[model samples]
Structures are given as structure tokens and as C-alpha cells.
Target: MQPSLLTSNASHRQYRGPITTAIFDWAGTVLDFGCIAPVEAFRQVFSDAGVPITIAEARAPMGAAKREHIALILKEADVQARWQAHTGHASNEADVDALYKEFLRVDEINVAKYADLIPGALDTIAHLRARGIAVGSTTGYPREVMKNLIPLAAERNYKPDFVSTVSDVARGRPFPDMILANALALATPDVRGAVVVDDSPTGLLAGLASGMWAVGIAASGNEVGLSLAEWTALSPAEQQAHLTPARAKLERTGAHFVIDTIADLPAVIDAIEALLAAGERP
Candidate 1:
């Protein structure tokens, strides 16, 4: 006999009721409508180095840590060729480090230019707070950049309880570190009772990896590459073209929901709560 190993039932505690906390990504999701800061900074830094990467290339690695993002861009075939042609050598770690240093200098001054709180962010955050849902934020930006962006956001009436950044943890997006840092700082009793809302695939992936529900922003974020007014000005058919693919991209990241902007977040929150009450786990 195997000592009746199957006789004992394993039991574990779980939370099933309502979302107690919500974690948001900064740019594109809440503060910056189109996630413009990093993109502009990336493009400027590359151009200054004489590599001159295109906007599409600048945006392709939107949610990664800044230095890692630069490295990813350097790995691209087109960018690599351009770098070699311009510098007489293939891009290397030192080039990445140099570009990243420039990016820090540029973005620290540039982020404020795009810091307008996305329309409805304040209201949506207020709605969550009203229901006793603790709000926290995470970002791909480093601490110094966040120090600039956070106050700009606060002045606009949106302030998250805890702010986590790439610089605060060893790894950033597509990793669970920052989101888990938020969970810890916000003191979410159970990770399952938390929801993460972001505008990038990497950010959403990080949330799911942390065992939390993940939501994505489609039309208002990097995927669509448009501000609120620019998005609204598009013809429905035109809007559909960019939006369908953007939504699909986020869905491919395994998000629990995808909405156009943070404005639509409260409804998603309600839907998630309904599922939670039904004993669902993200």
C-alpha cells in the first residue's frame, strides 16, 4: 500500500466576490491619450544618433523597459542596417547605452508635453475609488521620468495610491514584477481580487502572469496611435480599420477585456465583478 496517499483532500483558500484593487499603466491607459512621450523620445534619440528610425519602428516596442526597448529596436533588420550604414558598425551595447542615456535626458523634458490626462481618466478613477477599490499605477518609464509625469497627472486630478516603475524592479513589462509590486504596495488581500488595465500587450501579459484580470485599451493607445480628438474625427469605417486590429492585438495578449479608452473602464469593472461573484478567476 502507498499509505493511502489519495485519501486526503487538498484545500486552499481563494477569494471570490469583488475586485478590491485595480492597477493601471500610465501612458496610453490613463495619463497620456496616445502614449506619445516614449515614442517621440525614441525617435528623437535615434535621429540624433543619425540612425533615424521610423515612427512605426519607434512604437513597435512601446511597453518594454527603455534600454531593453532600444535594444529590441537595434535588433530589427532595417534598424540594424541603418545603424551600420550610419555608424560604420552594427549597433552594440555601448550604442544602446548611449541612446538610452539620451532618451532619459529627452523624455524627462518631453513627457510633460504629452501629460494631459486622457479624457475620462479622472472620472473613471473616481468611480473605482468610490466603490473602495484601491487604485495603483505601473509604468515602463524610469523613476525620474515618473517623478515628472506623476505630478503633471496629479495636477489634472488623477493620482493613484501606489506608483510602480521599471526602475523600481529588476524587470519590467511582460514580467510580473511591477504589477506584483503594485499588489504588494496596495495590499490586495488576494491577487485574484485585483484587475490590471493597460494599453500595451506587454503590460497586459504582465498582469495575467500575476494572476489578475487584465484589460486593454485599443483605440486610445499605441496600437491605434491617435489622440482622443484624432480618434473621434475618423470616419466610422476609417476608425474600424485601425481599431479592429488594435483590439485583436490586445485580445491576443489574453486580456479579459479590451475597450477603446479608460473612459470605458467602469463598465468593464462591473462586468468583471459580476463574473467574480459567479466564482470566476481570471
Candidate 2:
């Protein structure tokens, strides 16, 4: 006998409870002001290859698995033309491998340097915990890169209850595996009762794919492209100039809410609870 369709729907239940988990992306979303480490590493690798890329090009595929990130850059039309001109051939897996090796080397050294918790990240997590939310994290970095980072971040009071890295999943963001891993580790009741907070469109896409609320961090992260101190030093007009495009990009990518930094997260969580109370999902 065949199984009933109801059996499939049985495990597809939605939660009516208030949000129970807040899964965050690590670098830009929680630590490393302005998401500098990986972007710098990316720039270094490409420049060393004699095919330098602008910071914008380096950041264009932020939040993907490192190899996938390299692949995406290689696929860019201008980058592809440059690579062919430089190497006399189109980029391939070997080129990706070479770039990734350089990236890993540069990133391992720099990741610890940038491990300082973004201002207000610790307090925000504490506030979330006080509200009974379990905090989990996902990172584009593999476990090896995170080995130093996890401990460094914890020492700085920015630890999450659980962390899932690219090594822990078959695929990284724009795929839901990392966030699902967080939900499983946190024992979240349903995807509907969770939030995914990140600083990249790929991360937001992961949340949307997981049927969870997607919160984008704008000015304090990749989009604004400034260190915390640099951002603070900007005049109000300059700040607005950075924020307008960043916020628009996040909204365009389907973030349910966008805030400048983690410091603003607690209030957003409060608003999300109210929406949940109104029977909204995601």
C-alpha cells in the first residue's frame, strides 16, 4: 500500500510560538567590524595573482562558501576577461584552488586580528537571551578558520550557544543547510519561530529559503564598507549616503527588517514578537 500525502504534511507543521532562536552570520553580522577579514583576503589573493579586484568585486559574493565565492568572481564577465588576458586562458578549478589557498592563508592570520566583537554585539546577545531566545551562529568560514575565531570571540564576550560553519554543511549560504543546522542544534520548534540575521544577500536568501525571518545588518557591515570607527567619523550626510544604498539592497533582497547594527536588534526582536503575536510567519 502507498503512504498518504498527509504523512508528508505531518512533519511540515508551523509554530505559533514566539521566536525561539536567533541564528546569525558571524563576521559582518556579529564580529569583525565591516566584514574586513575575508574581503581583504579576497583582494590579496586576486592581486597576488596579477589580476587585482576592487573591494566591491571582492565583496560581491560575500557569505558564500569560499570556493563558491571564488567561482562566482571568476564567472563575472570583466573578471573572466581579465583572467584570460593575464593567464592566457579562462579561469578553472585550479585557479579557484590557488586563490582559495592564498585566501585561507591570509584569512587565518587576519581572522584573529579582526575577532574583536562588534560594539554592542555582546549586550545584544545578552538581551536576546534574557528574552528567552537561543542564539546560534553560522559562518562562511570553515571550522579550521573558526578554531581560533570561536575562542577569540568567546573571550571577548561574543559567543553564541552554537555555531555551524561551512565545513559542517554540504553547502553554505543561499542554501539553508547552515541555518537548519542551527535550528536543529538549538532545538528550535519550527523555522517560522526563528530569525536569521546576517549582513549579506546570500545569508538573507538562506533565511528566506528556510521559511524564517530575515534581518539584514546594513551600515555596520559589508554594504556600508567602513570600519566602526570610520563609520562613526562620517558626517551625517556621508553616513546617510552609505546607509541609503545599503538599506535599499537589503530590502531588495527580501530582508524582513534591516537595521544598522546588532545594537538595534533587540528592538527589532520586540517588533518581530508583536508580528508573531499577530499570526505572521517570517
Candidate 3:
């Protein structure tokens, strides 16, 4: 079912409190260095369907609901044309279903492998919690995948107070449902005072749509598309090649702030609090 949209009037209300909640995306924003699990799953699923997609193409729809991600790619003109050329027919819901099934199967097995917490993620969440901010999470992964991820992440000392998955909401990122769900779970009274941190355009848009401050993490995510080690190995000039475009895209999508990684988040939070003090509202 589609979630009821928050009325425009509701979104415009001013709130006077400090930020009480910080909702984050899972893979790219906090764990799974390089955000490689889903990307690899996308590649494998499409290639298995005889329609291979480039990494850029696979990453294009990152942060959407899994099935919707597949559908979005199919809707792309180039991807559609390629699908027809490969299969001798137009792609349809059936094709999406097949691809999504394969993706889920592949991802279920591989997600845990990439579940290592991104450096600074645990510390950042702990810092936020220590400041009396409630830590919550939203993710593109469904319940089944999260069933594995949640425990793994907790074992490594990186657990949020609440987790809202795609299955927990009617719609996923680019929509506000998941973020709103987090607010509901965190028992936050005002959405505007919460912060949403993510690494994808859709996730940023979701935060903006929810009238929350949106911070985009650039390097440690899909946009930069490099593992921590891989990113560190790149020459400064080479790294700029990735950071420039990724930061631009996130900004274009209305991210309030685009920083390098979650390690910089505390300062960003301080900046946000300062803005709130000055009567700013997201």
C-alpha cells in the first residue's frame, strides 16, 4: 500500500528543539565499505538474464526499493534497447521479477561478506547517541537481508536504536515513508528536527522530502564507488575524479551538506544545531 503523503501544511511547521534523531542509510552510509554488495548483485542478475549492465548503470538506481531499482533500469532507454536486442523482446514485469529474484538470492549470500562497519561509523553513531540524539536507520534492503545484517553489525558495535527497512514502509527512498517511519519508531515529535544521512541521490531526496536536514556522504559510498582501501590507494588527483561528480550529484539532489564521510558528521551536526539556533529549518 502507498503511504499517505504528509500534507504540505504539516511539512511547513517550525520546530524549536534541538535535533533529537539521526537516521542513516545502511550500506554506503554506515557499513559495507564501497557499497559493493548490491552493485555486484545487480551486475550478476542482469548478466544472468543475458543483459549485462555497466557498474555506472547498475549504480544509477541505487537506494530505491530492490524491485523498483530493477524496474527503473528497465525503463531507461538504453537499457531497454539493450534488453530487446539481447532477448529479442521488450523487458516487462516478468523480467523484473526474474532479475529481482536472482538479485535477492545473490545478495543474501554476499551482503554479510561486506557487512564490516565502515571506519568511524560506530564511533559516529555512539557520539550522536551520547549527545542525546536517537540513532535510527533506513535501508534499501528488505527484511530478510536485514535479518542477517542487523546482528552482524551489532556484533561489531554498530547498531542503531531503530531500523526501518523497505519492507517496513510502503515506499522506499526518494519517498519520505522510510524516514517518517524512523521518526515514528524513534518517537520523535517533529520530523524537521531530525537528520538523514545517506550516500545516494534518492536517500538525500527522501530526507529533503521529509523536511529533514539531509547530509550526503561522498567518498565512502556508491557515488565514489571505491572500497576504503581502494579509495585510499588512489592518487589525490585520481580521487578528485570520483569525488567531484559524486558531490555534485548529491548537491544537485538537494543535499543540505555533502561531506566526505560519516567521520565528518559530528561537525555537520554541530553546524545544523547552529542553524537551528539561528531559526533555520530544513
Candidate 4:
């Protein structure tokens, strides 16, 4: 259900960067804990390679383009040592491809199975649109997933003005290609008029690199390492209870604002307006 807003005489203060458009990340940020399903798939491929990793451990590299994140994980986890112990062999390019294929399969199937908008997310998007802002979305989700999910999104009437995929970008998150593409689509006179809302390091990096204001969604059920089921089981109250720590953690990520939920979005917008009115950049 959409959030109800009572009409009031209060003025809608315009801010220099009150975010005329918002770009969203698909999986973990908007589409509910999508990283975990792909983790299970990667586990299968890695098991065949004689390396086993927990789904929890596997959620760490979210918001990055898969291949880029996998390369990062391989180096960080000393995959060479793991490979030596597991199969007395070094990791190969072919292993990466095999794991990638498995990961993509899980991502594809689970896009429908698990794709619920984050609580308050739809309402927040609606509120932004109601205020005359364009809403755009970009995702690490490849075009194949978009083929199914875009139709689903349209069925729900939460459609965005523009959508871009990681596959369409030269470099994905942490490089700003997808965010930049979405910003170009928004086409506002000032780049600051749009904001990127994200929950991961790579996403924040992308927003900052794109030179757009960034808001970090730091809701409780979305702490860095939780799986989908764990997040879903938390009641809204419980989720709100967890937001404090998430906010603190994300503050270090350099976001202009750290919001516990999309419900807090209006307040953040007000803050941005205050900043702009004072001739300060947010």
C-alpha cells in the first residue's frame, strides 16, 4: 500500500540538492537481500573447486559488479592458498567463468522469488514522484534479469524514468559508470539535484565518483552480512531498532545523510533544503 500524505499548507522548501531524481541499486538495497541467493550458487561452484564458503561470508562483496567483486574476493581471501589446500591447484580463469555462470543463474531465478521492494521503499519513491522528481534506477542486475523484473515493476506501477544495468556500463560500481548513466538520463540542470541511495561501499563509491549527492540507506534489517530470511523475519519495529548501528557504520562511508528507512526520506530532504538555503552544499 502507498503511504498517505495529508495535504497541508506547509511549503515544500527547495534545496540545491534536494534530489530531483533518485538512482537505486536493485538487489540488496531495493530488491531484498538478493546477494544471498547468488552466494548459494557461488558456493556450489566453489565447492566443486574444493573450496567451501558460508553464504554469510559470501554477502560481503555486494553492490559491486560480480566479476570485479569476485576478483577482489579472490585476492583478499588468498584464493591461491585455498586452492592449494582444496585441490592442490591454483585458481584459473575458467573457474571464474564457471562460478560466474552459476552465480548468474541464481540471480536470475531469485529476482522473482525474492524481489520484494524494501519496506517504505515504494512509498518513498512515490513521495518523490508526487513532489515532481524523476525516479531512475540502475542495478548490478544484468539485462536478462531486467527483462523479467522491469515488467514486474511496471505491474506494480513503481516504474522508474530510466533504468540501466551493470552489463551496459563500461565499469560498474566503485567506478560510477552506471550511476553516471542514470544521472545523464535524469538530465537535471544541476547534477546535485539528483541523489544516489545505496547500502554498500561500492554504491557509495559510485555515487561520489559520479559527483552526485549520496544518501546511505542504513536500515537495521540490512546490516552488512545478514541473509534474506534473517532480514525478512524482523518486524518493522525490530528493523527500526537496528537502524542506529547501521547509521553509525555508514556515516564513515561519506554519505551526505544516513537514513534508517525511506520513511525518513522527507526529513533528509528537509535537511538538504536547510543546507542549501544556508548556501551550503550537501
Candidate 5:
């Protein structure tokens, strides 16, 4: 028999109670939908290193620890070819190291300026909190960057019960390390009860692999310069033309549900509640 796509049985080996916590990804999921700061900073860093990468390309490493993310991009198949094409230079570990430092500095300084709470983000968070659901935040950003944003996020009336960094955990997305950490921090004993909301495919896989509810918020205004609907409306060929890299990620890490904005979270919550009512997993 074919395996059921929606029902999670194996991953959630330990049957637990309903989900009472929600794990939120920082950049595209909550704070800023477009991820303006890191994307622009990475582009500049790459340009300075003689390899000009677009903001879209720079976001490939998102949802993973900073160093691991950097390594992924530096070792990408097109690393040498793209570098040669854009900058007429060959990139090595030393070049990657220099780019890393510049990117970090720019990220630290620029993150604050890019803080736009995604539409309905704060409202959804508030709604969950009011319902006694604990909200926790985890990001591929290092501690410095997360700490820098706390004050800003607080000013906007959105605060996470636990704020953690990717470095705080052993591994990053596509592995359940960060989600596990957030679960522990939130004291959520049941995986089914916790919801993981993210915009990255890796992040969605991480949550799903951890047996938590994964909600993919494919929001518009991505630094990639196209709205989510705009990207989706194109012909399959056109869509593939624009999102080859992102599509590769998605194909590898399929999400349970795809949504265009945080505004659509009510439907997600309704589904989770229904699952709970049915006693399927949660």
C-alpha cells in the first residue's frame, strides 16, 4: 500500500498529547518577510570577494547554522563557475573566510534596519499566546544577531518565550536538532502538539522530521524580487526558470502545506485542531 502523506506515524514514535507550543523561524517567518538585511549584506560580501551573487542565491543557506550555511554555498557546484563568470576570480577557503567575516558584520549592523513583522505575524503569535500556546523562536543566526533583534521585536509586542540560535544546537535544518532544542526549551513533551512555522524548505523538513506540525509560509516580498503568487502564477516552465534553486530544495524537502503568507495561519491552526480532535497523532 502507498504510504499516507499527511499522517505522521513513524517519526512520532512516542505518542504524545496535543501540541501546546509553536516554533517560529525568525527572518521570513516572523520578523521580516523579505529578509532584507542578510540577503543584501551577503550579496555585498560576495561582490567584494569578486563573486557577485544575487539576494536570491545568497538565501540558499538560510535556516542552517552560519558557518555550515557558508560552507554549503562556498562548495556549491557553481561556486567556481559563478565566481569566474561574475568576478573573474577563483574562490578558495580563504576567500570564503573573508566573506564570512564581512557578512557577519553586515548582518549584525543591518538586521535591525530590516525588521518588518510579517503581515498577521504578530496577530497570529498573539492569538496563539492568548490560547496558552507557548511561542519559541530559533534561527540560523548566531547569538549576537538574535540578541540584537530582541529589543526590536519586543517593541513590536512580539516576544518569544525562548529565543535560540542555530549555533546553540548541534546541527541545523534537514536535521531535527534546532526544533528539538526549541521543544526542550519550551518544555513541550509532545511533538504533535508543537507547530513549526517556517518559510524555508529545509526548515519545514526539520520540523516534519521531528514529528511536529510543519507549516510552510511561502510569503511574498522575498528579496528575490517576486511575490509568492506571482512566482506561482507563471507557467511551469517559467516557474522553473525562475526558481530552479529553490525548487531543487523544495523537491528534496517537501512541505505538508504551502501558504503564501502568515495571514493564512488560521487554516493551519484549524487543521491541527482537527488532527487533535481525531486523535490521529497530536
Candidate 6:
């Protein structure tokens, strides 16, 4: 389903260092600290539908396209049971489509309110740009949401060189389409020369499946699942306890590296370049 990290006959071929582009997932990776907007909207949609799914259920399918995300959430056993009990029938495709429409309306309305850039997001992008590394972005958000969100971010001087949305591609998270689209649009010298910085395991898998290095974001992203204020309110030990499993979860996704947030990304980029210099593949 994806290009191999290495060509069969090119085992001797080596990648050079200093990387080219860094692709980012939008919500938690760069802005909206805990990826709150979508989850809130998801919950609202379900509640409006009389199912009233929990936050965990809403967040469970966070990295897929909104419609696909709605489909995944509806596929949850408990959600299905609740749906049946509430409506006296199994949820069908029409329910999915209707809920997705509501999700779009709700999320698009709320996304701008959560568009604040994650701490160090702008700094990290600046640092990468200074070193001639192009910064690109991919997201599960559709164009309607981006229409509101992008200007908000740009108004704050945080804009990626390229932005690819779920609607821009045939498939979204856990699939390589969005990530590869970023690399291809950037004209990256090689796939391995690009990095994917994501907060979700699904996004990291997409990056790896695209043959790009992946850096998982733990604390500032979904794995920690806390708002910036809520996160900062925690004592050091509290945060540490959360990050342990967060790191492990992303690590299990086969990410080449994992760090707290985008602020910690530049150093990881340098580390990945060292691997590239040694002819290592992500």
C-alpha cells in the first residue's frame, strides 16, 4: 500500500543528513493543545443524536477524517448498543451521514475558538525555516474547518509552507495519503529526508507507512489528553506518570522518535539527521 523505505536492489544506497521537510499534523501537533475542538464537536453531535457518547469515545477515533471518524465512533460496540436502545434500531449509514453533517457544522463553528498555537509551535517552525527545512501540514479537518482555522493561525503568524486537509486526499489517518501528499508537494529529495511530527498514533503510522521519519508528541497532544492549562496545573510527577504510557503508546506505533511537543522537535530533528548521516532509515 506504500513505497518501501528501501529499494530492493539499493541496499547500499544511503541517505544524507540535515533533512529536508517536516510534516505536521494540525490539531494537537501544532495547535489546540489537547485536540479539544473535534472531540467537543463529536460529543455534541452524538448528544444531539441522543446517544451522548463519552469523551473517550469521541477521542478514540481522533485521527480520521470527520465523516470517517464519525463512522468509527459509531462502530464502537457501546455506542451501537446505545444507539439501538435510544432509537430502537441499529444505526445505519444515514445516521452516519447525518451525524457527520452535524459534526461539520459544530466543529467548523468551534474550531476557531481553539486555534491557538501549541506552545513553541511557532518557535519550532521558525527554527526549522531558518535552517531551510520546509514546514508542511496535514490534518483530519476538512476544508470547511480549515477555512476558519487557517486564517486564525495565520493571523498569529503561524502558517505552514503547505497545508493538506483530509478533504484534499482520498484517505486520511493511519493511511499514508495525506503525509505522502505533503512530501510529494514539497518535492522532498527523498521520503526519508522528511519527517512527520504528529500527536496521534494513527498519524505517526501514516508517516512511517509513507517511509518518513515520525516524531510522536506526547504531553501536548492527545496521548496526555490534557488542556495546556490543565497540564500545567499538574505537578511534575503527575505529568511524568502520564507521559510514561503516552510515550509507550506512540513508541509502539514505530515512530523513530517521541517527544513532549513541537517545542522539543528541533533537537529530535537534529538527532534524526545524525541517523540519516549514518545511512539509517526511519
lDDT of all the models against the reference?
A: 0.90, 0.89, 0.89, 0.69, 0.72, 0.89
Which tens-of-lDDT digit does each residue in 192-213 have in candidate 4?
Answer: 6777877776787788787777
Tell me how far the alpha carbon of residue 48 in candidate 5 is from the true structure, in angstroms, after superposition. Answer: 1.4
State which candidate, 3 or 4, has the greater TM-score: 3
Worst 10 residues of 4 by lDDT: 5-14
> Higher-TM-score candidate among 2 and 5?
2
Residue 162 lDDT (model 2): 95
Candidate 6: list runs displaced more than 4 Å: 1-12
Better candidate number, 1 or 4, judged by TM-score: 1
Scored by Cα lDDT, where does model 5 land?
0.72
Q: What is the TM-score of each candidate against the true structure?
A: 0.95, 0.93, 0.92, 0.82, 0.80, 0.95
Task: Report the C-alpha displacement of residue 251, candidate 5, in angstroms.
Answer: 7.8
User: Per-residue alpha-carbon lDDT of model 3 for 17-61, expressed as tens digits?
Assistant: 688999999988898878999999898999888888899899988
Q: What is candidate 1's TM-score against the reference?
A: 0.95
Q: At residue 63, what lDDT does model 5 achieve? A: 67
Off by over 4 Å in 1: 1-12
Instruction: Select the stronger candidate by TM-score from 1 and 5.
Output: 1
How many residue pairs clash per model?
Answer: 0, 0, 0, 0, 2, 0
Ranking by TM-score: 1, 6, 2, 3, 4, 5
Q: In model 2, which regions exceed 4 Å deviation?
A: 1-14
lDDT, candidate 5, 1-282, per-residue tens: 657743566545645345588888888778665666677777777777777765556777776676666667776767668876775666667776777788888887778877767778878887887788899877878887777888888898888899877767777777888888888988996788888878777788888899888877654334233534455577878755655544444445666565656777767777777777666662
| Better lDDT candidate (5, 6) | 6
Q: How well is each residue in 1-282 modelled by candidate 6, as lDDT tens digits?
A: 545645664765667766999999988999999888898999999998899988889888778888988888989999999999999998889999999899889988778788889989888899999999998999999988898889999998998888999999888889999888888888998888999999999999999899999899999888778999999999999999999999999999998899998999989988989888877888
Worst 10 residues of 6 by lDDT: 1-10
